[model samples]
Target: MSGFACASSCGLIFKSKESERNVVSLFQYDGLRAVESIRLGAIRCDPKSSISTSAAKCGRIKAMASPTVSAPKREKDPKKRIVITGMGLVSVFGNDIDMFYNKLLEGVSGISPIDRFDASEFSVRFAGQIRNFSSKGYIDGKNDRRLDDCWRYCLVAGKRALEDASLGQEVLETMDRTRIGVLVGSGMGGITAFSNGVEALIQKGYKKITPFFIPYSITNMGSALLAIDTGLMGPNYSISTACATANYCFYAAANHIRRGEADIMVAGGTEAAVIPTGVGGFIACRALSQRNDEPERASRPWDKDRDGFVIGEGSGVLIMESLEHATKRGANIIAEYLGGAVTCDAHHMTDPRSDGLGVSSCIIKSLEDAGVAPEEVNYVNAHATSTLAGDLAEVNAIKKVFKNTSEIKMNGTKSMTGHGLGAAGGLEAIATIKAITTGWLHPTINQHNLEPEVTIDTVPNVKKQHEVNVGISNSFGFGGHNSVVAFAPFKP
Candidate 1:
C-alpha cells in the first residue's frame, strides 16, 4: 500500500495508489480544475506509483505556518501619547473637580426647579440648573459683567484647567506659548447674549444692541477668548455636535498633540443653556423631563419611569498634553487618553437609531483606536439620558459590543448631573477618570425600576468600589452624533 497526502486545507490522506489516482482523475474534470490545481500543488503522491504524473508534482507538502499575530500598535512613544494633566469644570455640583466627582459618587442629585427665570408658565419647569455661579477670580469684573454665562463658564473652566495643570502665570511664561492651543466648545453658544441682543433689537432699536453681542454670542468666541488670554497661537477652534461636543473636542485636541501641532491643549466644552430661551427651546421640542414634582429624580436614566432628559447647564474642561512635554515638566498626569471615536447615525435629527448600530460601531472603533480589547474595558460611563428612546437605545448598543456584561459596571453620570448638552462628555470624562483613580464607580441614581432590556450592572442607585482596568465615557448628541472616548490609568 502506497500513501498520498494533500495538505492545502483538504487534509486528505490516501492509503492506496489506485485510490489517489481515482481521486486525481475525478478532480481533473472541467468543473474541478481549481481543486485539481490545489491538490497537484499541495499533494505528495507515492514516489514509485506509475499513475503519478509530472503535472501532479509529487513532492512532500510542507504545511504553511500560521501568520504570527501580534498585538495592535498602541501609542508608546512619549511624543505621540496624550495624557490628561488636569481637569476643571463648572458643574452644578460645584467648580472643583474633586467636589464634582465626590458629589456624583455620593449619589447627590443636582437637578432642581429652574429659578433662573420664571418657569411657572412652561410645561417643563425644572432642570440641572447651576445656582449663583461666580467668576470672581477667573474673569475680570468688566468682562465678567458683560460676557454671557456661557462665555463665563468657558473662561472659568478653561482657566481652572490651566491652574490644575500647573500651567499658572509663572509656569506658562516658561513654556512655548505658540505651542499651546484652546478648543473649548459650546452647543448653544451664548444663548443669553443672543437672546438679549434679539430682544434689544426687537423691543428698542437696532442701535440698542451691544457691540459685544456678535462676538460673545458666537460658538468659537469661547475658544478664541481663552486662547487670546493665554497667548496660545496653535490650533484654536470650537466644535458643536450638540451633546457630543465635548468628546469631539477631546478627540480633536488629542489629535493636535499627537500630530505635533501643540504640546498642550486646553480642550472641553461649556454650555449655559438654562436661560428662558434655552428652556423654551427644549420645551418646544418636548425634550425636557416634566418631573417638576420630583426634581431629584428627573434625570433617571435606564429607569422604566423615566419620562425625558433633564436639560442641564455647565462647563467641563481638561488639560491634555503630550507625554513627553508633561514628563519633561514633571506635570501631574491624571490619566491617559487612550483614544476616541465619533460616528453619525445618519438616521434621525434628534432621535438615536433604535437599532443602535451607530453607537455600537463608535464604541468598537474607539477600542480599536485605543489599541484596547473589548475585555479590557471594565467600566462604561454611558450616555443614558432618561428619554424613552435614548436610554434603551444606548443600552442595546452597549450590549452589542460587550458580550459578557457581568464584568462591565456601567453607569450614567447624567442620572445625577443631568445632560449638559455640549458639556456632557467632558463632565462624564472627568467622572470616568475619577473612577479610574479612586476605584469608585458612581451610581446611575434614581434607578428605582430598571427597564427590562437593560441587563448590564448599572451600579444602580448606589456607588460601587471596583478596580477599573479601562473606562470609557460615552456621549450622544442630537442630529444622530455619537462619541466614545477611552481612558486608562497611566502606566509609565
Candidate 2:
C-alpha cells in the first residue's frame, strides 16, 4: 500500500497493512494530516474513507490547516496612453511644421544650388538648404560657437516643440522633471565638425583644433544639451541606425513610456551634412542628383526619368507624452503613435534587398504592431528618395504588402523637401501627423510620367484633402536599414 496526504479535521492517519510494518507519516500542514488508505496495487485511498474514523485510529496529528490559494494576477491599468502633444521642425522646405506642410501641399520644391559651401566642381551641385537660421538665438551666445550645426538644429527644434506643446517654463517647473526624457538621433552626427577638425589639423596643425571638437562630434551630446536645457532627467540617449535613426528613436521613446520608465519624451532627429564633403561623398557613390539647372525638379520620386536624391539637412521634433500626464495637465493632444517597426535588409551593406523582402516585412510588422489592417491605411508617406533603385524597391515592397490595396494614395515628401538622410524619418513623421490632423495630403511634384511596373498610386501635381483615419511613413537608408511608423487620429 502507498500513502496520500489529505486534510483531516483533527489528525493524521495511515491505512496500509494495519499489522504489517511501522507506520510512516508522509507530511503535515496546519490543522491537516497525511492519511494513507489501502485499496489496490501498491497503495491508494478509498473514495468513501471516513476522515474522522481514519484520524481517530492513526496517532500522527497536527494543528489547524490553512487553505491553499494562488495569488491574484495584477491587472494592467489602462489609464496611461501615449499622445503627440506638439511638433516642431526646421527643414530645407521650411522652418515650422505648418509652413513646411503648406509648402509641401502647394508642391513647392526647396532644392537649389549648393551655396552653403563651394560645390562648383562636384558632380551634384544642387541640394535642399536651410536659409537664414541663427543658432545663437536658441543657444546662449557664449556656448553657441562651441556646438556643431546639428546640435544647434536639434536645440531649435526641441525648444519649438516644447513651446508648441505649451510646456512652458512654468509647466516644466511644476512637473516631475525626472520623469521627462529626451531621445534625439542623427545618421551622420557632427560630420561637419569632424571634417572641419580634419581640415584644421592638416592646414594649421594640432594646436588649431578646438577643444570642444570631441563633444560636438559625438552623437549623444545633442540629447545631453537638450536635457540640460529643459531639465529632463529621465532616460536620455541617442540612437544611430543610419536613415532609420529617427524612427527607431521615436519607437524607443514610445516603448519607454509603455514600460512605465518615463512619462514624457522629446524625440526626433537632426542632420547638417550639406557641406562639400557631404555632397561630394554622395556624389562619389552616384547617390545624388546632378540636375543643377532645374534644382527644384531634382527629386522626382516614381518618375520614369528620375536620377537620384537631393541631399538636404534639418531637424524635426515632437513632444510625446503619456495620456494620463497630458490629461492631468490639460494638454492638447495632436495625434497618437499607433506603432512602428524596424528591420535590416542584411542582403547588402548599401543597396536594399533586390526583392524588397526586408522592406515589405517591415511594413507588415509595423501594421501588426499598430493593430491595424492593411486596408485601413489611406495614405503612405513613401521614402521614395528619387533614386532609381530605392524608389522602385519601396514601390515593390508596398505592392507586396498591400497587394490589392496597393492603389492607396501615396506621396513622396522627398519630392518637395529633398531627402534629409537621418532626419528624413522625423520630418516625414511630422508631415504624416499634420496630414491626419488637417486632412490635407501633399503631392509628388515633378513626377511627369509614372513608371508602368510601379503599381502604387502616386499623388502627383495637385494637393487634395481626404478623410484619412490612418497613415504610415517609411524611411530606409544605407547599411540596409528599414523603418516604418504608423499613426492614427486620436480617439480620446
Model 1 CA deviation exceeding 4 Å by range: 1-71
- What is the lDDT, from 0 to 100, of the residue 32 in candidate 2? 10
- TM-score per prediction, in order, is 0.85, 0.83
Which tens-of-lDDT digit does each residue in 436-486 have in candidate 1? Answer: 998777778898897667767787776666788789998877666788899
Worst 10 residues of 2 by lDDT: 1-10
| Top-scoring candidate (TM-score) | 1
lDDT minimum window of 10 residues, candidate 1: 1-10
Could you tell me how far off, in angstroms, the CA of residue 274 lies in candidate 1 after the best superposition? 0.4
In the range 1-492, model 2's lDDT, one tens digit per residue, is 000000110111222452236543232112111122112222133445332322211111111112342322211233345789989888876577778898887788888887887777777888888888876556898788677888989998888899899987678888898999999988888888888898999999999998887778878888999999888899999987777778888888988888899988999998888887778766665567778889999989878888777888899998888888888888899998887898887754555655667888999988877777776676898888877656766766777776554326689898988888778888999999998888767779998898666655575776655456678998876666788888878886
Judged by lDDT against the true structure, how good is candidate 1? 0.79
